[model samples]
Target: MSGSAQVRAWQPGLDGVVEVLHAYFPSHAYPSHTHDAWTILLVDEGVVRYDLDHREHGLTRAQVSLLPPNVPHDGRSVRPEGFRKRVLYLEPDRLGADLIGAAVDQPELLDPVLRRRIEQLHGVLADGREPLEAESRLTLIEQRLRQHLRRQVVRPAAHRDAGVAGRLREVLDAHLPGGITLDEASKLVHADPAYLVRAFSREYGIPPHRYLTGRRVDLARRQLLAGRPAAEVATLAGFYDQSHLTRHFRRMLGVTPSRFARS
Candidate 1:
């Protein structure tokens, strides 16, 4: 441990959120371990190096790291000045299962806007005077994160067969509220993942992941219109939570789920 190292942990008044950590270290190195909840961290100063899924990542003030549940990882300071970080530990189910792949695949995000919003959220949590305000801000933060992770495939090859894409769509529709990975979908259709993505995009005008998300949004719309609570609609439509549902719903329909329900 470094001479200047310090760590603090506390809980916030929010469901599915486990705890928050604020820490500083000069030379301390954390041994590999796993967390039961998702570990989202904001690096406030200096630099930190970590390994997730056998890949190394360096996080700085402009970056955020999102580690999924039960994933083994290790960390240490990357500079002589050490590092300061704020971490939020949330239940694994706080985000949709469909989003986990991206989180695991790319744990660190270099977005200045997201970094600033997270800093503001930390301030609100530390003040402890505006629980609802903090919750709302957190919702937006998660939404931006999901949007960033959602990769868009542009201008797919036109030479692939359209029939295979149609069959894949049918399989996806049959498994609504449940998701199939690109690898799984490829195996089902006897095509490579790259080909499947391009072919799907060419035939449907959207990638498979986006297409499935749209279907879920459609289901959420019907449930909201039938008087179901937004939170319940989120679950029934395969969304991770109400915030997850709201993010996609607003993006697709130009209105939030609550507003859509009322209209």
Candidate 2:
């Protein structure tokens, strides 16, 4: 067994955020310590056993865990080939309203959207350049995390809006390229237009029209990367014009579409 281990640290973003990716061989352990920020650990390979809050939990590749600010925890690799994991550290105060009332002490698995968002956040943070992009990426991750935690949970006997929301999202995705009006989206879900507007806003943290526009912009960015001209991509993406697309592209990506595409 190895007598000791070393940790490699990587700082990818301009903000106070930092990523410490660990590779530990058998018998290696993390001594108990605490810090005033959030830590998310995703086990990329092998099994890990850790004691947090005096309770022991076994974690594997498919699982992700959170350590609250100032919580004492210790962990070690249990695999012979050693263990590899990605850890993201974010300041709670910097995160702000993005936490959406989520207590730092609560830990949960990353929902599908959140999983991808967090993954992207890591990718940007891993990049040695583009601290601006990393800051924006981290902000986006916090927003998604908050939305996931705020979603309404239905009881067993309760009527699930799950089916309704799912169906509506399907329709919205189908019409994304062309865009959909608030009334049109409401009709597809068979609910009052006003009620649907509020519900969709609550669920997505954005009105349906804005969400559709954002989706269209996402497509536009891809097209730009594929070598499409800005004007042409703007029209196909359902934007009123190139200037309209430019406004949103800058706001969301921190760069113009043309610049982002090239980068």
Candidate 3:
């Protein structure tokens, strides 16, 4: 329980994730409302009381609440001191259909292992770790959640339009130094945005966004190695600014762009 209350929200730079919220409430309640995305709550301290699917549940620290998309729910502190929590709002398509079904059927999971893994993932994401490393951690977390829920594993059949992935990659490369969005890429390949993301990840082992970011990093590296100014390289590499380029460069390569150039 915290004496004061506060709430902060930010996107995690991942596809299909809406936002994450870190909050501490000493005395607050939420009126019934529905969300278009799934609301996943992780309680860190104290107690949280919420009603879902016409049932009331009191969740304590180390517990998780999985509210499916479009479900009406209300939440508040269960005790006098209130609670601290982290919440993730995810698009329904981000998770497999079967797993989402399992989550809806059993909304609250009381597994310490799952809770700890989720906490770890949050830390890595919040700290701005390497994009590839963060993606790996997130995949592992999803696998563990699926295991805990006892969901069936359904492997995807061979992709019908496997060449579309390659075409999408070509399109991405053609637009570099600028950028192409997921929607734009999907249209070029005549695929749905979600399908394109999954297909690209499966075909190349990285999502489109991460792949595009990596391309930007690769371009930046070359420009830096060629003795170009970091500011010019930022623009040449499709970054918003030098600071933005530096942030991703250091996260991916473990050194600042200038330092890397010096080395």
Backbone clashes, each candidate: 0, 0, 0
Regions of candidate 1 where Cα sits further than 4 Å from its true position: 152-263
lDDT of 2 by residue, 1-263 (tens): 34333344444435656433443344456544343456777777688887764557777777666665534456777776556677776664644433422433345564666666667767766665777777777777777655544563522322335455556666777986776776787787888878776665544434566656656765775577567889899998888999999987655534567765554
Inter-residue clash pairs, candidate 1: none
**lDDT of residue 83 for candidate 1:** 80
For each candidate, give its TM-score against the true structure.
0.56, 0.47, 0.54
> Which regions in candidate 2 have their CA more than 4 angstroms from the true location?
1-6, 95-106, 148-263
TM-score of 1: 0.56
Better candidate by lDDT, 1 or 2: 1
The prediction achieving the highest lDDT against the true structure is 1
Ranking by lDDT: 1, 3, 2
Clashing pairs in 2: none
Q: Please, what is the whole-model Cα lDDT of each candidate in the order they appear?
A: 0.75, 0.62, 0.71
Runs of candidate 3 with Cα error greater than 4 angstroms are: 97-101, 150-263
Clashing pairs in 3: none
Arrange candidates by TM-score, descending.
1, 3, 2
